[model samples]
Target: MTQLSSNKASGCTGAISPVLIGAVAAALLVAALLFSASSPGRPSSAARSAKAADSEAAKRYHKDIKPILEEFCFDCHADDVKKGNLSLNEFKDDADLIAQKDRWLAVMKNVRAGVMPPPGKSRPTEAQQRQLADWVKYGAFGIDSRNPDPGRVTIHRLNRLEYRNTIAQILGVDYNTDDEFPPDGAGLGLDNIADVLTTSPLILEKYLKAAEISLDGALPSEKGREFSVQGSAFKGNNNATGDRLSFNGAPEVVFAYRNKNPGSFRVQMEIEVMAAATGTNETSTSPAASGIATNICHFVVGVQSGVAPLAVLLERDFTAEPKKHQFVFDRVWSIEPHVFKINVTAPGIRPAGRGGGGGGRGAAPPVGPQLRITNLRITAQPTAEVRRFFAKDAPPAAAKELQDYIRQGVAAFGLRAYRRPLDEPTLNRLAGEIEQRYGETGLFNDSVKPSLAKVLCSPRFLFRVTQTVPAKSGEPWSLIDEYSLASRLSYFLWSSMPDDELLNLAGKGELRKNLDGQIKRMLNHKFAARMIENFSGQWLQTRNVMKWTIVEPEVLKREGKTAGKPMLTDEIRQAMKDETTMYFARIVQEDRSLLEIIASDYTYLNEGLAGYYGIPGVQGKEMQLVKLPDDSPRGGVMTHGSVLIVTSGANRTSAVKRGVFVLD
Candidate 1:
């Protein structure tokens, strides 16, 4: 498992000194004034002819630049690693740079070319450029570096989608119930990373409820059916009837009986299983045939009276009719019963019989059915005691039985990207809280309801909790209290709680000092899957894609689209999801520039999606990464089906929303 971490730089190795910022700022101001004086926005004939002379004049020192340099340069070119090493630490006036005239000219040159500080960096305007030309004429000055005031901010808990994806990845279970929890509040223009996203009592209740729902299991339906076994004894022992029976849909059992079984009886059972189909297959628009193996039922003989049932016999090695190639489980049984009602008990199987007159001497059930009940012959052996017998597996608890559920909450809703392992005490306390909520409130199914509500609601989970209370006298103090810091750093960057490795680092007192290594390790973690899910889903509005339901055929035709044509099926939705996931995955793995998300030459699409976009030759349900045509405006999240649909309003796309999404 890979660790997740923040992208922030650490240790400040070789970082630009603070003094350089001031020097650069001064250089920019002077250069801006010089450029303005030399060039006009609309050039005149005389101005163009004097360009070379103006340029030479701009390069001169002391005679034309001393005053300009004194006003701007002396404050920042002091000796200091304070802001990118402008080094004004020793000087107080313009003469300092004047003594190093060549250095001042070099600064003047870079500033005039508009390349010194770089765009988005501290740079000079046209007016400042003209001043720089004048400063070179007067000579340059050194200045001290000044630090800016720090910005104030709040930390936030992980959002709902992130929390959901994180838990699903951790537990390998796709339980997306986070939507039922209370909505997260936005901070810093994003619900995901805001420190202001705190939890409330209602959220705690939701968490507990979600936890219970995630862990709880329930018994199969209680409804039962009855059938009969029939055969003609036309041959010797073991050669009478070729009975074949099977069961399907949910795990269950079967029963068999013969009228002349006054003594001993024997029966057989066989089974075959097929792979289960997923949600996508059920909603496929294309029609193609697929076959599945018929599961044979395992019969358990039981004596039934009123609503109670007692085991009557157990089966051994028995083969179903037809061939062995189509067979799976083959077991046979021999039993002798006295004063016990014999019945076949395969809950998930349906047998074919003739009369439906019940299994009696002259009564017969249906026949030639997909399920059979032959191999019937009674013996004259003496009846055994009604004490006990055997059957298949035991019964599970019904609705009336007691149950406890445990829900693993989502990852993105907490400090996910950090490395922190919750202690046993924490888990136990959480479990206790879970138990209390269920037992006290009588709402076991909604355990996650309370689990989410409580954890997300708590200040302990939401706040970074950086305030350190000193240990009492004679008590041992922790080394740096890195656990709190670890928690803060992870939530700040990754927008989720730390995992075991991170927590372990904090425990070992390594995270705070070794932030660089920890951050690197955390970025490679599997839970980083949560990062893609949360960041991309919410930011890209991929969650809103499913709401685009199909309307009437007339409406479709009016929109210049097909009505009878299958628009978005379950398969297509899943394909779109795969596209979203793949795109997000690339962002994390490649550490790609975020700007690529606004406009890229390539996108993920399937045949259905390709058709929707009027692209040709794409066929089938599988999703593929395709290169978008240069002519198409469809690129990145703005053009993605999910994102576009999500940002759209009723009956039309809203430019305002799309614009805000792009800007945000």
Candidate 2:
């Protein structure tokens, strides 16, 4: 780990400063002015002389350049042999070649760099290469910069992370439904790329389901939710049998419950465990020590979504006589959909099956060495927030009538859902759905539920229509609408829907005013923390660092390392990730140069990361900015443990992957 973190700078570092941005903008303005000044359409004296020069260059193209091309360059680029997708013969003359300025520029750059002749076949002399580059500049294909024809903007949809983040903000709850949604397609090394985001029927279904849970959590039900174990839909067991459901040894017994609202839950169940006798008193028929084991057995009780690890609410170890035990976790906070799990593991003894009446079965369940889960009940408990927010006394949004309440509720919800102002038609359409549902059900939640699902499933919510726009007529560029700009800013910076401030500015069509100030403010916002994680995660592929098996205990064993210090512990790996993300967060919050990301004299570190990098003085788990040792060679992302871990091979560090990580 020290070696990984002590290497010199590698991957991306600090961003370009505002001053550099201003300088680049100024240079672009100058170039654009020059292009305008040398306009070929003008009938001025300058335009006439430029046209004369073009005529002379076209004449020289056949005589002077043709022989040069045939001598040293045409082997690969000639007719019927277009290596590098370049065929100089395709261009009729300088005018023809200059029409495709991008290709011409690429050809000129390669020739100028002297990488075109490719070091093998009869190479051109240094002077000839110089002459050829000059000819490209002032002779046949006189170089000119040009912007290519604009293409249609790709439509973007909120990726899974963005959707989860937006739902959390919009609904005030941490909702994780990523497993429900299909994986978002990535493009240009980013999952948020618009070109790859596409809507499908499956994703629409997931969106509707997500919206229902979000709305249900936002407007919680007072009655709460309950699930009983009898006839419950359980998996990983013998079968879906009722209270008789029991499994022996290593088999699991999972009872699932789809928690509708955000709240706490209570799990009450009776587990009957039975194991074969395996002690000094095994042969003894005495009740005191029939089959007490020396080794201890343990089990876990926790709530879960999918395969999340168990959290202990209550734990105890007992001897053989205590086969049946009651477990009641008074309250476990559960916001999203999850299942109550009771995992029991009894080691060092095989599960004893039904015995002959000779010795009689152990004082356990009918099946020996097994766990019988009976009378299981998982009930959701309403938190104080839920109790106050959805009190029956108050009407939705303070509207007196149910209809007006539904309309206001839908409108307010629409603003957050759409992340922009709703048109009259959209408002009517959404409100109409709720009103129609309310008419039939006569319940506020029932009306809101289906209508909210409708809103979430709509294309307006699924895809970003604000992004697609045509350039203004007769102009090469057009200003993005403020709403579109807001979407871009929020999604790129915050990875979520626009906040109230951005939406307010967009609504007023004034986001473009003092745009630089807004960018700075956004960079300083707390949401910018997500940008540190999301952007740097995608850029450096640091997300892969969490797959901690890259350099595990097994790696050391497999590599025949007899004895060594562990390079990474779980805490160290976690600290390594913190170091990478915190470093980027500092860059954003401190307004540091982007190049600093490539190399920096200081980095964020806690005690674990500091010792891992051989730096002293850092204390505690809380990370803080630490000045790097002068000769430490620990200056950039390339040396970070997260980066090195991702780039490492099974049993050793991958020099090839490390090099590619730096170059790529």
Candidate 3:
């Protein structure tokens, strides 16, 4: 990570640069001279000439522009017609036309893109179209070149997904902000656009509550404690069935624990091993005359802290036997929470069935050895340093150390929250708040939690605030600061705050220079997959599939369902949605051509969707990539069940809707 100097040079600084001041003075002088020349009493010769020129231009508008619009546009944009709510006939003069510049701009954009004047309609000649283009470009109501306004962007608040992901990255704690916040409104097929992302009193209240919840989950508890978490609570085993646990390699079981206080912690596992079943029936009176040896189950139990990747604290193999076993793991470290995993291997042994039912009388069954975890317990005892830091009765000697620790923690957290280095005043204020809280609460964790929550709720954390740089004289646009650029890129690609590498490059002012490399790196990052769900979900309108109803008469009859409501099960709808999203992800990840979005030779499918599409060979609940035959009509997102269902009406397909979607 390269470090860059902080960007303090912004347009908002109090003192204006000499060049800008001069340019402003010149503009004022010109404006005053024009006003004086156009004063009411007596018009100068120059003013008369300008008036004559304007009249000639008005004549040209009526002759060239008005005639063309009447022929090619008025049929749709006239007063009685007003297609798209636009009445070109209302603009009688230049002022009226200029006032609605944005509408005219849209017209110009469409004309240039060749999307207007729908196919099969009488089209305007090239010469007539160019005349209209010139009228908008160089006529009296023309846009100003010197002050070309690109429009303003509304200040953006992080949406629910962004908030959750950003908090996870910054605090190393996963939070579900979606459950706490109201759904965000979308615009232009995008929910991230600032204009539609509104805030209300309820949203503000939710933010406060969410902040508190996030802080509580991230921060450690105030004191050392002991607790027991069921081993089945880990990843794999199902306690409801009470079936014997079995794994070929690493057991999916993982215990996640947060160490609030740095100290010596103990983890104990109470596991019961079942002997390998050698015969088909447990009630069999005798074994085969050959006397084959029974299979032995081996397992390696280990504890690995989250802070140290792949660092195992305890790892040993034990033979499976019919008895209870206890193992204790001890680790002394000052770090965040950790996950402990167990690995088991038993060759030539089949896994136990979900239920304890034995096989039918005639056949031999393949059963394997298994381990049953009865209990898992953990306890933490604070070290001397931790004890002193949170001591109820503080001594004078440890006061400085505790304060220093608090200051460091505050600074570090503030830097991450703000996504940049904080100014002295800001850092001091945050540190002071923590100190005050500490004075009130004597315990370190209790003191820091509230301050941390306050920081999380701050606008700096909630919004991506960019410093606006003022454009100098003759400059067409202002350049965004490096930190701002970094945030935009990260949120666009990863839907989260910039990681350390990105932030470091921004600090060194080299982010833009190395943008291509960064982009390539980010594309390969795990979070880049978010683009498929966030962007494609909206772009292809696949999210609407959840609300779509499969009401085709034949289809409804086949499925035995009523009309006017969603007949497809949630699983089928989800599978349909996944097909499009995964297709998009594959295109982006594999760097496929953009045209593949319209027509691809392959698609993703699961058993449910495959059966619906009449595609054979796919036979599982999980989705997999499959090749489409040349004659298949289901090659692109346009034909996918997700898109087809959503674009249709409750009872039948709407040709108009499908056509408009294709055009869009």
lDDT of each: 0.44, 0.62, 0.65
For candidate 2, the 10 contiguous residues with the lowest summed lDDT are 1-10
The TM-score obtained by model 3 is 0.63
User: Each model's RMSD to truth, in Å?
Assistant: 21.7, 16.0, 12.9
Which candidate number has the best TM-score? 3
Top-lDDT candidate index: 3
lDDT of 3 by residue, 165-211 (tens): 87766654455555456889888778899778776656665665555
Instruction: Output the better candidate (1/2) by lDDT.
Output: 2
Model 2 off-target regions past 4 Å?
A: 1-90, 94-150, 222-260, 263-393, 396-400, 439-442, 467-478, 554-567, 587-595
lDDT of 3 at 475: 56
lDDT (C-alpha) at residue 562 in model 3: 60
lDDT of 1 by residue, 518-588 (tens): 77776666555666666666666665566655444655667897778566666666666667777877866
Q: What is the lDDT of residue 443 in candidate 2?
A: 57
TM for every model, in the order presented, reads 0.45, 0.58, 0.63
- Candidate 2, residue 390: Cα displacement in angstroms equals 9.0
Error of 1 at 640 (Å): 2.4
